[model samples]
Target: MLSIENSKKRVTIHDVAAAAGVSISTASKALNNTGRVGIETRERVKRVSVEIGFRPNALARGLLSKRSFTIGLLTNDTYGRFTLPLMAGVAEALVDHGVSVFLCAIEDDPAMGQIHVEAMLDKQVDGIIATGKRIDRSLPVDLSNLPVPVVYAFTEGRADSVSFRSDDGQGAKLAVEWLSRIGRRRIVHLTGPEAFFSVRERAAAYSAATAHKEPVLYGVWSESWGHEAVARIWSAPGEKPDALFCGNDQIARGAVDALREHGIKVPEEVSVVGFDNWEIVAAQTRPPLTTVDMELKELGRQAGLTVLALAEGRPVEPGVRKLPCRLVVRQSCGGQPSEK
Candidate 1:
């Protein structure tokens, strides 16, 4: 592993000049792409700098150029839970390109928009990335009018804002297909709290994927929601479902616990599948879980890159860029591929 401390030794224009056999000012122009330098020499200087592991001091360079070289991140509390990994992916990508990130979580009213925006502007952030999942209702309409370019992740901005969307519909279809492959026709759905676009897309996918057989849908994203859904299922007087598809692993875990209390056998009497391959919760369950991995980190990275492009005045695709989701099969869903 290359130690950052080892890599942090300053590599100045003088060093690049000495290495590239060019004058100091010529080295500066080539490395910063400022002033004017021959294209061939510029490329040679840049290549040699990379070879020697030269990293310019981001702050001093920004001061000279008058660009902050930083992006401000705004998100809800789950930013760490759902947004952090994506942020990590985004940060990794940005670091290579020499950008720094400033992050803050907004949990209250009048603060998400007014307060956070004021702070970022005060610091002169070059761009802004806001995570939309679990967004508090207080973000003002005028928040989009920030002086710098602003991007939203796991969330959308209003009016001419470019955003990235998760492929939940596709994820739902994959989940349903997995269940169908196991010969589980009567699949039930557990959903997240009402009216989220993600829940709606998943429901639509469920409807589409099971259109041939008409599977059932129910439940929300939380363990409590799963508990309530199971109680309802237990109380209803009808033929029991063969499988339960949950909105996320949290609900599936809760449902699994409740099923045991009701003497139901998982993957035997009932099979279960869920969304979001939440490892901590997914890995620790009694029978483990078969769930869809939405690749939130990739999603965040995509959103970050998109926003950076827009900020840089580069053209980006107008419609949503859907991130990929993978299905992770485990013991909870009977370990049997659906055939119907």
Candidate 2:
């Protein structure tokens, strides 16, 4: 039988141990699954704690274990275009373990980044995950010798450290192959600047996938660039490309709009594919884009777990991990709406 007054009071580990007929140390070990304890005794303590609504004090646990059960997420993607989805994944992965995430956006300011890093260190964060707008660039602040473990996601990292990013080459190949599969013989690649590592990688893959038959248009990552590229190609072309594989959804949207203005029908006379299946841009496009998804959320989930493993003293091989990308089909590609 439960007493109303007792239920209203906080159930401490001491009360749990008392109810389970175990010592305080034993109860702690059982609840945390730390020290070796008899299986039956551990089960009994856990059952009793649940029945009594025993919730361990996070601060007390952190003090005793020298672990804050918190992670710091540092990013320069102030727009939140990439950071927000990745943050959600990190939070989802850590929430089950009673871990919290602290987010800091520095926006390319070294001083601000250093300040945020110091603050997170002051808070005794268990680990830190550094992310950014581009994978070729590093954060403004130095994170090389931090006391806490560091994991890099969607950003450049030290050669000796662990990092995660999408396989841009594979993603580009997927896009090109899809265009070829739908009987589109001539496919043009409209992408961002050649200086960008991702742009170069995707361009190489696009060339190989198309047998070096199509032109690779290097331009800025903007809808205006997409529109201008279309105008240039159509004006001085032998035969207009039957398909356009863009660097991003924005470019794809612009190309679609230009094609529409030129009295061209998408998926009927021309097919368009894009990278970065950003819903805000991809879904809202006139014909909805068939694009490549980098799966940033899954990348974040893996990065979060890797950092947690490091914080827990678990061994993890350090290297750049390139997760695979998938193609999302929509009305623009002359295919049934589906995700691959």
Candidate 3:
């Protein structure tokens, strides 16, 4: 039971122990959810602590535990397109455990990357999560043998390191299969350069889904390419494709605009689906774009947890973790309604 203590004074573990009629060590174990304490005693101790407004000092706890309870996020993605959502996920996963995340954007500068890495190490960060704009590329500075645990998210990682990335093939298959379910045939793939690893993976999936009936149109990841590709397809001597699957939301927006200009009714005539469900492009399109969401936030959540586990001296398997994708339905695909 909670005793009548001075409300103005800072309540420490001793106060909680006295209020709950338990020893200091038992109170500590109960509060931290460690050691073998009876359920009733643990509950009583926690209840008394809350009732007495007891708050643990984070600095003192860290010093005693020999852990900073902080993580560093190192990224080259200055645009924050992917990093923002991923950071949100990491923060969400770690906040409950009193963990703070420090974000450092190195922007492809090796010197700056090294400087930021050194600063994080100086601050005694428990772990680091390396992320980037693309999955096939690594950050400029090497993080091979740091003193802390390193986890990779949406970036190239070492062969033995644990990494997390969205499954491009799965995302492509989701888009293609959604179009197929809506009775779209002769689907043409308008995507970015074939040199990109993601482009190749998506193209392979598209080919397998479509049975190689149509060739993929590879170009830059731009709206102009999408527009020009549409013009070229419409001007061809063969039958027009009933649907178009773009590599990204920007391309999908361009395709939709071009179709509108060419007097082709969207969905009614040619359904369109895009990848990377980028809201800026997907949500503002004429009829709104139905795209594949890579679930980067969930990937970040998993990466954060993995790094935390490593920091806590827990075992984790070293390999690439591929998260599945989900299709966001919208008017562009003539779907029932918009669903993310």
Candidate 4:
């Protein structure tokens, strides 16, 4: 065991070797059961190593093994703002498995994602994790054609490659269900701009959420657009919608602002819902906004795991690896039952 008083004298394979009365090579071979070492000696060395605090140096092992142990992160974000924590979860999951990481942010252009994907082919990345909406499925997906696995985060891969994505339909369903649970039958949906895949799916899901009902849906991607949509809804209705659903939290935030400005009370008079949990910004609202938790971190983690598999000449998973969305109840939505 490590001595509590001697923090400087950290345990090493050499210390285990000395205690076991064996050369470093013997200790290494014994620990890894490599280089034709005897089983009994290996067992004794392992036992002694376990007796103290000894850990194999993963970097050294990775170096010797010629496995770059690095996964390339491809994205078009100008800066790795949201991508950072998401990548953190994926990296933590990979590093424990002795995988290293390489990250590159492409310019905000769709072409940049394509260019980066080609660039990664020349680099020593074992796999790729493409993030953000700007990533063109057509560009980096050719890597899927290679022996190295490729994965995508918060983005979609081309049809030519196996891709993993959150089940946006499920997320949409969850948002609607939560609103339904709180007596928000007369709901309104405000979405982001129509260019992105998520925007389209979320729109479909939102519209579907109001099937057989008179609920209204306004498709727009920005807060300004959300404000406009809300304004339009109020102009028509005497009182306005009982609930609101947004494509993303940004739009939801704007919707809430517009509703409050119009002398409408959220949840009590009108309930609001949004996708993408985004707790940092959502919680700070005067009345914390009730939103759906898309679990982006877990989505990134799964994307990474699938990509690792593809890099190994293995079959990549087909179909949506649908992630679940949670209803984050806050002050913005009413907990009471509805009349209509």
Candidate 5:
């Protein structure tokens, strides 16, 4: 037996065949389940191949199967906070299909995006999944005329392209309705920049749910903005909001800290709900945050499956698909105590 580690030798089909005590042709047929071969013999060959650490060459398999079995993921999110989860989802969704993904971070540079796209095209990727930091924004390159199928995930797409994104309105409604059910009437909406598409969508949902008693507070998507928003709302000293619905977790965390500084008990004095159930930020809060989860990973999985379907010539309905979001219950909303 070849000592694969000591000899630094690549295990081949020939080695597998020899280990299985069969001819190369017979071994190939048995391993591939092609031609005529006894089931017992096929199982033996497979077991021997595994034992000998035989790995078939992907390029050779592609040549025979007429597919590279590779896909490209284009993104401008260098930080990878959003990209990593989406990529993991895509990988999980395509695991059964035996497909691999190539991630390209263009960093919002048009030239860089084109270079990555061309490189992937040269490698003959089966399809491309274009994603970005913002759902309303497009990647820096053009995928309109690629030879392969392209799907948009959390990124803007051309008119006819199939795209998947979070349902911002539904997620906001879940948070607002939950607060309302818990008897929170004086609700205030604090969110990010008004120019952002998601902010508008969420604000609209909050207003509709609350009947627009107080105006929506639009500011930066940051902890500082959240801190300042609380100050501004309390400065007038009218009827204080009993509940605050923030656009994202960062803002909610800031609000919680500010409330504590002002001697207010969370959920006891003022309930808070945030969007984007980012565990890193949400779980670290004092009482933890009750936030709406956009289910980004699920969005990526659906995008991956849709792209693969397009690549395989399967009929996939074109147009934007908004996936549903769910509420993640935590202590911030005066819910039951969580298990430690």
Candidate 6:
């Protein structure tokens, strides 16, 4: 069914052979890095192949290796806020390894999760990376007994599975430290509901860093809550805070708006730092925002590599692994823009 034009456009091993000034068998051996060949000649052949944009047939390569060269990413993050960057990291990590990904959006549906799992199994995916919107919660379906290797990223899983997450406490500490370094004292912590484990971890870190005298404020993860918290904190004006550490960007943005209404200048009057350096929210703030980034993409890259290692019969220690978070500096906290 291949058209003549398409057939002509396809680059074959013969083309590599011709370009590399080698026989077809020699080209194949050089390309696969198998059989005896001169080192210089092999390098030349590879360079030429790359220059010509030659790509081997993946189906044929998979057939020889008995690996479908595919992976499955199962997530309950329907909004893709967490999953999108994670998926990009996974795909980028595996592209050179000749593996593709199948994304399954389960969206808190047990039946849907089961269906996707079964489908990935049917396709013989080498492994699966289970991720979600939050690290505190697990996906609806069971992954403990799956046939393939499973790695958890930004989500809870079985106790013994290899997992990756951002160091929430450390990230919070970073934010607090940044505020202190900028000579802002009287810091106050405003965060989400107490039910989430991250909220507690962040609050504890904030307390340790500041020996926080003021009580921690817990509310819904929303801009409205941020606005309300600001109002309450300013109501009793006995020595107001010079800095506000928000749990997320939404709350920070709301706090900034409320501060504006109160005629308080940002950074100059009260430096504001937020978590989850969500670009859309943080970068668009009046002076931009200084926030902590969980590095979810890097977590995904590590998770991808770990799952692939397991699939390739390599041993990896199983337990929860906490990756580091980074502080992205912007104008909100009187910091220069991040170079990276």
Leading candidate by lDDT: 3
Candidate 5 structure quality by residue, lDDT tens digits, 269-295: 999998888899999999899999888
What digit string (tens of lDDT, one per residue) describes model 2 on residues 41-147?
99999999999999888888788788999999999999999999899899999999878999999977898889999999998899999999899999999998899
Off by over 4 Å in 3: 1-55, 338-340
* lDDT, each prediction: 0.77, 0.92, 0.93, 0.72, 0.91, 0.91
- Local lDDT at 179 for model 3: 90
For residue 100, model 2's alpha carbon misses the true position, in angstroms, by 1.9
TM-scores across all candidates?
Answer: 0.79, 0.89, 0.87, 0.78, 0.92, 0.86
Please write out the lDDT profile of model 1 over residues 1-340, one tens digit for every residue: 9666776667776788899999988887898889878899999999989988787776677777767767887776443786778789779768876777888777655545577778877877788877756422323325656788876666666547766667888999988888888889888887886567788788888987777354444545678888788888879898878888899999999988889888888878888887888888887776788999888788778777766786677887665567768889888988654322
- Comparing 5 and 6 by TM-score, which wins? 5
Best of the two (1, 6) by lDDT? 6
**Which numbered prediction scores highest in TM-score against the true structure?**
5
Model 4 alpha-carbon drift over 4 Å, by segment: 1-25, 35-66, 79-82, 109-123, 134-147, 215-219, 237-239, 311-315, 336-340
lDDT tens per residue, model 3, 1-340: 9788777678899999999999999999999999999999999999999999999987688778778899999999999999999999999999998899999999678998999999998888999999998889999998989999999999999999999999999999999998998889889999998988999999999999999999999999989988999999999897999999999998998999999999999988999999888999999999899999999999989999999999999999999989999999989988576445
Best first by TM-score, ranked: 5, 2, 3, 6, 1, 4
Output the better candidate (1/3) by TM-score: 3
Worst 10 residues of 5 by lDDT: 331-340
Candidate 4 lDDT at 43 equals 91
Give the clashing residue pairs of candidate 4, or none: 69-100, 148-311, 149-310, 149-311, 167-322, 191-220, 192-220, 192-221, 193-221, 267-270
- Runs of candidate 5 with Cα error greater than 4 angstroms are 1-7, 15-25, 38-48, 337-340
